[model samples]
Every structure is written in C-alpha cells, then in structure tokens.
Target chain A: MHEALRFQPVDAEPVDRADVVAKSRHLRRVTEGAARGLSLTIRGLRKAFGDNEVLRGIDLHIPAGQFVAIVGRSGCGKSTLLRLIAGLDAPTAGGIAFGEQPRAQDVRVMFQEPRLLPWARVLSNVEVGLGRERSSADAQARAERALVEVGLGDKRGEWPSVLSGGQKQRVALARALVSQPRVLAFDEPLGALDALTRISMQQLLERVWRDQGFTAILVTHDVAEAVALADRVLVIEDGRIAEDVTIDLPRPRRRGSAELAALEGEILKHLLEGSEDTSGL
Target chain B: MSLIDSLPRVGAPKLPKVDGLIPWIVPLAIVLVWQLACVTGFVPSRVLPAPTDVALAGWKLLLSGELVRNIWVSFWRASIGFVIGGGIGFAFGLANGLSQLSAKLTDTTLQMVRNIPHLALIPLVILWFGIDESAKLFLVALGVFFPIYLNTLHGIRTVDPQLIEMGRIYGMTDGELFRRVIFPGALPSIFVGLRFALGIMWLTLIVAETIAASSGLGYMAMQAREFMLIDVVVLSILIYALLGKLADSASRALERLTLSWHPAFQKK
Candidate 1:
C-alpha cells in the first residue's frame, strides 16, 4: 500500500547529506575518468532576427553524455542557441559543428508544449520519432518499448488529449528517445507542469540521461532545476555564457542539501550580477 | 487555510434520460392528432390525406415497383453529382491549401463565384443543357461544390503551425507531413464540409427535379399533384425525409469511424 503512493520514498529515513555527497563525488570521479558520450563544440555561434540580435557571438564546448543546463532571464537567447544546435534554425554567422557529423535523425527537441499530434494515439506519436525509414511493424515495436521505458505502457492506445500534462511530456520524451538520438535538446519542457510533477519529471529525465548516455542541453528558467539536474549549470546573460559552474555532486543527490543550495546561490549571484548590466536593454 | 475544502459541495443536477421512448412520444402524438383530424373531417382530405391513406399509397407504389425505380434514379443522379463536385472541390482545396501561388491565382475568382447562389443559375443552366438530366446534374453538382471547397480550404489553413514545425524538425518529407499532420488536422473540417454538401445535394436535386424532370421522386410527386393524389404526394415527401435521414446517418457513422481520436466523438 505504501509503495502505491509514488510521491513517497519506499524507505522513510533521513539521509545524511555529507555522506551522500562524498559517495556521489567518488562515483562521479570514477565515471568522469572513462570515455564519455558525444561531445559538442560551438565556436562563435551568432543568430539575429533581422535588426534584433538574439544571440551575439558565443562559444562553448560540452562533453558527450554530460547534462548541461542553460538558465537565464527571458529572451536571453538560450532557446535560440538550443534551436540552432537542434538544426531547427540556421546560425546567421559563426559555425556550430558537432564532434561527429549528426544526421537529421540524430538530434531531437522537446518543446515546452508536448506538441503531440492530437489525431494520433500516444504510441503512434512516439512512432513519429522513428521517421519514415522504418516499417510500420518495427516502428510499433520500438514505440511500445519506448512507452514502457517512460512508464506509459498501458497508455499506448490512449489519445494524447486524455493524458495528464506530465503524461504528455513523458510521451514526448519517449518520442525523442525512440530514435536513439545522440543529442536531446529540451526547451523548458516541464515549465507547464505542476511543482510535484516537475520534480518527478526532473528525476525521470536524470534517470533516462544516465541510462541512455545521450548529450542533453536543457534550456530552462528555473535556477534550482538547473542546479539539481545538470552536471554543469551555465548562466547566460545578453546571449553569452557568463558563468560556467560545475556541479561536482553525485547522482541521486539530496534536493535541499546545503552543498546544492550553496551552488545554487553561487550561480544565482553570478546571474544577478550579470543581469544588472543588461537589465535596461 | 483550505478554502476549497471549506466550501459546500453541491451535487450535479441529474438530467432526465430521454434515450428510450420519450423522443418518439411527440411524433407519435402529432401523427395521432393528424389521423384523428382526417377521420373527423376537421381537415379536408383533398388538401392533406389521412396518414393511413398515405401509408396505403406508399404500399401500392412499393408493390408496383414504381417507388423503388424512381428512388434508384434519384439516388444515382445524386451520387454522380456528389462525386463530380466533391472530387473537384477536394482537388481545388488541396491545390489552394498547399500552394500560395495557386491560392493567389484562383481564390479571389472562386470566392466571387461562390457568392452567386447556384439556384439563381438555373435559368442559364436550363438554356445551356435544356430540361434533360444534364441540367439537373449540373445544378446538383454546383450546389454541392461550394461547401466542400470552402471548408476544406479553411481546414487546411487553420491547422496548428506548431505541429507543422514539429513535423519539419522531425525530418518528415512533404508527402509524409501532409499524411501524418496536415491531412489528419484538416479531416474534421472536411467532414463538416461533406455533411453540408450532402444537405445541399438533396435540396438541389429536389428543386431541379421539380423544375424540370421526366422521372424521379420529384417527378412522381409532380405527377401525383396533377391527378390530385394527395396521398402519393405525401408518400413522396416521406420518402425524401427517409433518404435524407439515411444519408445524414451514413455520414455521421463515417465521421465517428474516422475521427474516433477526437474528444468530442469519444463515448462517455
């Protein structure tokens, strides 16, 4: 009966933050030493919408399999940077080249809205990620497997409209992961979900990223969420990477730990300080 | 602290179920009243026949096979006209929906013509094709065309732009995009057009057959009126109602089958 309540922990006990942090640091160090997932290198990427320049020249490098979160005030070009990387839009000036040349099927983006086709069932929506290359039978099999991975196996036949907000996002995640894309770009996909649902989604995302080893770039406005899920949190100001703060904490880290709170504070400090200069603009 | 919890809970009002015999009661009562009036001579039988008389006339026509033959003839004409008009409408809609160049070239002209009632074109059509089947076919087809064309165009235009962007990002080809996204999105509206076109089909057929027809339900009613056979005329009217109801039910069934994904169509 206790296990039926998804929000509650299976074993109710107070965890020692210091001990968990030490263990996670050790685990992360061991994993970091090994060959990681796909790496992305961006050199002076610029995007301008006519006279309004969204992203000025920017440069960054992300190690493969590493989860990086970009946080900024609205209209800071974080989303634009993501769109450029996803190949949804072209870069106006500087070039963005992957470590390995990625195909059209190699990158997927999950928008704030689930963007599920209303006419399609949840399983068929996932099958869309497979594109036109696979047979209907193969696509169906893969889609079912993906749905199971997202804990939506029973809901495969349901229309997307019937699903909850969190469920819709889960189906979107399944759709993105079905193709086994090397890079997954999230454009504040959990912004519309309730607080509890958002936390669960963040955990789900962390677990999926760990299992799949896909390079993930999350563009979010939540500073705590960025500190919680990302290996490194990037603070963007005026379309530029103002601060790159590495989170040395390990997996399954305590949410409200002093160490995590301190890191969040540090990132917030930099963000506030950066915003002061560009606030009027 | 808990405002919602503090509020009184009011149960929803229970609606009376009219799914059984309740709906039939009113029509049956109306028929009873009519039959009583006819029997009592409250209404002249010459102007409006008794319900029993109309039923007997229908049975006679059915046994003689005249009713069946005329219904078949009208059905064929309607089917042919619908196919021709609906087919052209669908093609034009697709062309205008997909290509801005085509829309710009033809939409204005089409809209202008659409404003002119097809019924008003009857004199011109009669002059061109005479009082033959061609005149009736042309009228029925013209009447069916506008609704289908307009709704199809509106459906294509109003499809969510965000879904199209998602499709493009996912590397869907133009044909695949149309099949997976645009077409499904537009289908509900297309069905709306089809239902409307069907109603127009019947209306046009009735008018055309009445104006100039040698054989059909319309012609049979006209022949009955000439002989003052009010019962036959009443039977013909009933037959038209039956046909219209059947056509509507068939279209609704198709809608249910195709648009099962739509929330509005889902069973409670």
Candidate 2:
C-alpha cells in the first residue's frame, strides 16, 4: 500500500517501478510459503471421449499453495486437465492424489458460465458452496463473509438474474471460496466479461488466492492472463504439457509491463508454432 | 455494488390502478349495444334476452339460492376433477421425466390415448359409468390430464443441465440435487401446464354438467332452454363466463405468487 502511494507522483520513474515490483513481492510472499494449500499429484492422467483422446499420459505435480495457469489454444485439453484435477470428471487411465485425504469441499471449480441458480438469492447461492454443511447455523455467516470478500456484500438479497455478468462471476467466486477449498480450479471464468472487467476480475482472483493461501489452477486461452496471475504457466499442446514456464515476477504485476509482455510473447510464439507444426505438415 | 448500481436495470413502468378499467370498456359497450337493440325491438326476447332481463333472472335465482347452489356444485366438481387429474398427471410426468424406463414403458401408450379426444369419449364414458358422478369425474379428469402431463415432462427435461452439474460438484446428493436444482428449474413450465389445465377443467365441467346432472350451471342452462326461459339460459351462460374468469384469475395469482423470481411475472 505504501509502495502505491510513494509511486503515485512519479509518472514513469524507473526507480519507482523497481521499488513497486519489490514491494509487491512482499505482498505476494505473504502467502507464497504458507502450507495452507494442498499439494496435487497426477500420474498418467489420460482422458478420452469415445475415440477422441482429449488428454494423453499427463504427469505433473503442483506443490502446495502455488498458483498455476494452464494456457493453450482452444480444444487443447487445458480445461480437461483442470476438470480432472478438480475431480469434476474421472480420468480414464490415471489417478490424482492430494498430499492428504482431502475432504469433499477440499477442491471447487468456478465454471465459465457462473452456473448460479437464477431462482436463488446471491447469499443463498454462495451458501450452496458450503456443501452438506449448508444447514448449519454458521453457514449464512460464512457465505456473507465470502460475499464481502468478493465486494458483493450488498448483493446478498439480490437475485442472480439482476446481476451484471461480472458481478455474477464474483458471486460464483465467493461461492467457490466460501468452502475454503485447498484447491480452486477456474475454467476461463472471466472469458465472458468485458476487457476492463476481466482485468479487475483477474486482480480479484489474485487477491483472494493471496489472502486464502489456496492453490489455484486457472485454465485460460489468454497468454497474458496466464503470466499476469500465475506463479507457473503450463502450456498444453497436442494433449501434452509441451512447456512449463516459471514466472518469477512480483505480485500486482502491471498489465502492459516489459517483463509480462516478453513472457506472454514467448508463450504466444510457442503456441503459434505448435499450431503450425500440426497443420503445416 | 457500485457497478451494478451504475448499470441500467430492466424494469417495466409501473401500471396505474385506473388502467384496470380499460379492459372493461369493450365488454360494457357490447352489453350496452345489446340492451339498446332489445329495447328498440331490433331483436326479439325469444331469440336473446336483454342484459337487464338476464340480470333480473339472476337476481331471482340468487334470492331462491339456486344460483349459489348450482355454482357451488359446479365449482366442487371442477375442483375434485382437477385434483385427481393433476395429481395423476404430475405423478406420471415426474416418473417419466426422471426415469428413462418409466418413460419407455408408458409414454407411447399415453401418447396414443392422448391423441383420442376425451370429450369424444363422453358417450363411451356414459355407457361405462351410467351418466353418474363417476362419468363426469372420468370426463373432466381425462380432459385436464394431458396439458399438465406434457408440460410437466417438458419442464423437467428442459431444466438447465449445467446448473445440475454445478450442484453435483458442490457435493449435492441425489435428493438435494432434485430439490435444489431440478425441481425449482422446472417450476415455470409446470405453471404453464397448470394454467392450460385450468381452462380445460372448466370446459370439461360444463360439458359434463350439460350431458346429465341433478345440479350445476350447465344443467340449469339446459333445463331453462327446454322451457323457453331465454333470460334464465342467458344468466347461466353469463355465470359460466364469470366462473371461467375467476378460475383464470386464481391461477394467474398463483403464478405471480410462486414465480415471483421469474422476470416475466415481475411487475414494477
């Protein structure tokens, strides 16, 4: 916070930029080394729909509390991987194991469509994320806390139909977070939002992840989003993890900064080449 | 919240209470023209009674308590028939909607029976049940069945699968999934079926009463026609119209009450 105030007057001060970056790392590291998130291990993760193999023999481990972004072209099985990780779909061949025997609410997925109940009030929708504990006394309080975390406290009584697209997604996020899942998977949750709203949503996602210390797996088509929010960006090509790049950047990364743009460009190059390699031949 | 506040909400303008009189104009004008024609000798009372004559007949029937008695009988028949038919239809609909085996076993046969008009079975129903209360019940129940069944099935089938999926992911059990996701999602279409059935309910009741009944508006109207009492017949017809309107209004009130969350039902 002090870093933002100090950098307020210096329009493009290079020293201010470095200091901001350094200060933001302090913001990020607050949750970086916490053991609050569960570690995920996948082995020979294979999925096929009929004869179509969407994912083939994927093996990877995500350490506890790391934010990972999966990026690829459409139909690249990035979402498929995330779904398998979140246990939304059963993997045909392999198994996924958390570091421990996680509870039912240990993992939650925020779908692209928000998937809110149109009949339910915003607070009730969030309370749904409490799973079987929904009937408990503190459920409403917990749901309210989650809503306030997403900056939607006033929307508690509003119907989901009345909300804007971005607000609905925020409600969905609050629902996902209400359960305090050790692993949160997002399936392009912000893809439907306007560009400016998408950026703000991305920041909200980052803030919640930092505050809660939960491992986040975001699958998206935008390479820039992958670099901007994730500690590690995994590139899936031809149903495989083609490249895994560790983004050692600081928190609160600027949208159009040199470091982020270069990483995004490099990932985009790999993605474009992967497209040509399959279709060109 | 600021963003939502800044966004323009979709709301229709509030309707003033005086606008309620707008719908009465055409009906009132028709009555005025009919009364004028009757008074001027343009139309004979033998063919059609004037509106005032019908009102006078209605007042006489009300003082004798026959109007209320017949209305009560008809209303009772409609209610009982609707409950029986709607209950059975809802059961079949829910079964078929949720279970593939149930749908496969009975849906084709039900569809075949549905294709045969229930009113056309009136003679057959009379033969089978001897023009008794059961015959009336059979006809009215049969008439009210299809709309509720078809719409209930459709509503259940069309519930957004994505919402169901989300419910499953959030650790909803089978019962929870149905109650929280499937049932509420199917409610709007179920209400549509209910309204349609209410219309059929009144139509079938009138026909059943006209066929053979000791009491009811239809019976009174038919009996008055036989005696050449034009005013009494017209009064019965008017009463039937009012009863139909009342049933329709009741169903609409229910839709508004339950479907308050629905955008189409909400008023500014």
Best by lDDT: 2
lDDT of 2 by residue, B1-268 (tens): 4797677766845467868988989999999999999999899989888999999999999999999999998888888899999989998999999999999999999999999989999888888998688888888888888999999999999999999999999999989988989989999999889989998998998988998787889999999989999899899888888888898888889888877778786664
**Error in Å for residue B79 of model 2:** 0.3
Q: How would you encode candidate 1's per-residue C-alpha lDDT over A1-281 as one tens digit per residue? A: 11122222212434444334424543553455334356899998889999988888889999888899999888889999999988889999898877788777778899999999999999889988886545566788788767766667778999988888999999999999888788899999999999989988887787667656789899998888998999998888888888888988876777999998999888777777734664522
Give each model's whole-structure lDDT. 0.85, 0.87
Q: Model 1, A220: alpha-carbon shift in Å?
A: 0.9
TM-score to true structure, per model: 0.88, 0.91
Predictions' DockQ, in order: 0.74, 0.70
Residues A164-229, model 2: lDDT tens digits:
899999999999999988999999999999998898788779877876788999999888999999
Docking class of 1: medium
- Badly placed stretches (over 4 Å) of model 2 are A1-33, A274-281, B1-15
Q: lDDT per residue, candidate 1, B1-268, as tens digits?
A: 2697567757754455755668679879998999999999999999899999999999999999999999999999999999999988888898899999999999999999999999999989989998898898898888888899989999999999999999988879999899999999999999999999999999999888988899999999999989989899999988898899889989999999999999999975
Span of 10 residues, lowest total lDDT, candidate 2 chain B? B5-14
Interface RMSD of 2: 0.8
